[model samples]
Target: MRTQVAIIGSGPSGLLLGQLLATVGIETILLDRVSPEYILGRIRAGVLEDGAVRLLDQAGAGARLHAEGLIHDGFSLAFSGQDHRIDLHGLTGGKRVTVYGQTEVTRDLMAGRAQSGALSIYEAEAVTLHDFDRDAPYVTYQKDGQTHRIDCDFIAGCDGFHGVSRKSVPETALRTFEKIYPFGWLGLLAEVAPVSPELIYAHHPRGFALCSMRSMTRSRYYIQCSVDETVDAWSDERFWDELRRRLPAHHAEALRTAPSFEKSIAPLRSFVTEPMRFGRLFLVGDAAHIVPPTGAKGLNLAASDVHYLFEGLREQYRDGSGAGLEAYSAKALARIWKAERFSWWMTSVLHRFPTMGDFDQRMQEAELAYLAQSQAASTALAENYVGLPF
Candidate 1:
């Protein structure tokens, strides 16, 4: 088989890239180690920046999103037993975020891909990249007791951190950076209305808590916990009680509980691999970078990465230019670092550190107070939260 691009994953990044390429007549074949059902089953964050939403629209996947997604003008920061709302719309000059699930975005992209008659092989086994560093690049995989080979002009490593794409790169060729937080988020998803109309980020002596939702009827809640914590230790009642304790009085009073259908503890970490391109292969989304969820930047960052790579591919295929591809890594990393800083800063401000001394605690309080009271500080937070321009 031959294609212009061989995408190594069927996640949103790969699907979005393929959809965008198809808009201009470029052909691609997607390979994934998991089934499509498994892909959609994974729960993830869905806060969409204007730029991300625009990219989805550009890919022709915005119909369901715009029709069903919730729009939030502002969100509250809970501390000192009170709610402080950051006016995202006013601060960012009418920009707002849409509450759409990542799974839905992937589904829309998958539908668009299928409708375009592109190729996607789910449950492909033993996928491997070969000669990506040379002029000729190809991929091999086993399926149904048979071997198949795909020769492509380029390879896209959207398979995520654990996938073979990044691991295929020689260690000496890549520079890595990482920081693992001391805590994790114990999240619960239930079929009930959210405690509040808008998302809330709560800072309390106990830990950090986030109140988010997939829709008006499905609420997602999380509270900070030790890194070693497990889902087995938390029952529905205990999780609800712990969540309530982290919120302010009014929000706690307004909170409603139901039997949770999903529960898990995810560790927080910030990781990045420098120079997202390796010759003919490029890493996208979690394959290149990861951010703690405090700033709600994971999916948005992935969208931005997809945009950069799509532009480069488009330039190469349509404009007969190599400049965009050459500049892709530097451009993507520049925005990536800014987002990393924002996510790191938000995590620092909103989370309780296990090693926080008395002085550190007071400083965190001062920072939150300043962020809530000062217009300048609030503007900065709102701007970053709504996302920076592409």
Candidate 2:
């Protein structure tokens, strides 16, 4: 097989890139190690920054999102047994966020690619990249007991953190930075109406709790848990009872309890690999960096990486210039570091640490109190939440 680009994953990042590239007459072949059904079944964060929403639109996958996605102009912060609203629209000059599941976004992008007649190979085994530093780069994979090779001008390493893409790069050429939090988030998906019209982030003596939803009737909630905790230990009744204790009185009273259809625990971490590029192989999304979900920047950061990469490839093919391709790493990292800082800051102020001393707990209280009272502090939060510009 021969193509202009070979994408090493069929996730949202790869599919979105293929959709955008196809619109400009660039041919791409996508390869993934998992089935499509498995990809769509994975649950993930739903919050969409303005920049990500626009990129989906550009990829021709925004129709359903605009139709059914919930729009939120503000969210509440709970501390001191009260709720304080951060007016994102008012503070960010009318910018807002959309609540649309990441699975739905992937489905839409897949449909768009199907309509355009793009090629994607699933269940590809042992995928490998060759000669990425030379003028010709090719990808090889095994399928159906046969070997297949794709010769392409460029390779996109959108295969995520544990995938083969990043591991393919030599350690000497990569510099990594990471921080793993001591706690994890115990999340639940329930078939009940949300407790509030918008998301509420709570800071309580017990821990941090969040009330969020996928739609008007499908709610998703989370509470900070020990890193060593298991989902099997949390029963439905116990989960609801613990959640209620962390919320304010009014919200606790309004909360509706139901059996959760899905339950899981995710550890928080901030990781980044410098440069994001190795010769003609460009790392996009989780392959290059990861952020804690506190600020809801995971998917949005991936979309921004796609935007930077697509522009570089487009410029290279259109004007026969390598300037955009050459600048891809520095540009993507500049925006990525800012998001890393925001997610880290939000996590610090909202969650209780097991090792925190009296002084540390008091500092967290002082920071939240200042944020609640100062308009400038609130605006900064709103601006970062709605997302920094692309």
Candidate 3:
């Protein structure tokens, strides 16, 4: 089989790219190692930046999102027994974020792709890229006890961190930078109303905690835990107690607890791979970068990467110009680094470092105090939270 682009990994990044490319009549075949059910079963962060929301609309997948997703004008930063509202809408001149689960986004995109009559190969085993460095790149994979090959003009490596996309490149050609945090987030999802209407990032003497949601009736909460902590060690009662301790008294009083249906512990890390493009192969989303969820930039970062790469691909097919493709890596990385800095800064300010002394603790407090009183600092946070220009 032959196509204009062969996309590996049918996650949101891959699916979104495929949908957008299809808008311009670009032929793309999506290959994934797992079934669609397994893909949607994986829970993830939900905060959607305005730019990301717009991209979904451009891809014809924003209808359900705009209808069911919660719109938040701002989120609260709770510290020192007080909640400070950032007023995202006011600070960013009326820009806001949408609180929609990543699962829903994927579902909508998948449905849109199906409706468009595009091709998606699920449970494709041993998927491999070939000759991406040469002019005629292709992909091969196993299915139904047979090996198949697909010739393509370009390959998109949206297969994520552990996938073959990044590993396909020679180590000598890649430079990687990573920082693994000392703590992980123990997150819980329960069927209950959220403690606050807007999300809350709380810093307390014990640890860092966040009050978030997937919908008005469904609450998602998290608290910092040791890197070595096990999910099995946390029961519903214990998790609720710890979370209540970390929140302010008023919110604590209003908090509603229920049996959690989903629970997990995810280690925090900041990782980025330089030069997202390799010959005819371009790495998008988790394939190129990862950030701590503190600033809620992970999914949005992936969307922006899609935006840049799609533009390049569109220009390549529409106008027969290679300039946009040539500039993809440099341009994507510029915005990526700024997001990395913000995520790192937010993580640093909120979480308690293992080695933090008295002075370090006071500095964290001082930072929040100044941010609450300073409009400039608040605006900066709001701009990053709502997302920077794509």
Question: What does candidate 2's lDDT look like per residue over 1-390, in tens digits?
Answer: 999999999889999999999988999999999999999999999899999999999999999999999999999999889999999999999999999999999999999998999999999998999999889999999999999999999999999999898899999999999999999999999999999989999998799999999999999999999999999999999999999999999999999988899999999999999878889999999999999999999999999999999999999999998998899999999999999999999999999998998898899999999999999999999999999998
lDDT for residue 365 in candidate 3, whole number 0-100: 98
Q: Please, what are the lDDT tens digits per residue for candidate 1 over residues 1-85?
A: 9999999999899999999889989999999999999999999989999999999999999999999999999999999898999
Off by over 4 Å in 2: none
Rank candidates by lDDT, best first.
Answer: 3, 2, 1
Off by over 4 Å in 3: none
User: Is 2 or 3 the stronger prediction by lDDT?
Assistant: 3
TM per prediction: 0.99, 0.99, 0.99
lDDT assessment of candidate 1: 0.94
What C-alpha lDDT values do all the predictions have?
Answer: 0.94, 0.95, 0.96
- Where is the poorest 10-residue window by lDDT in model 1? 356-365
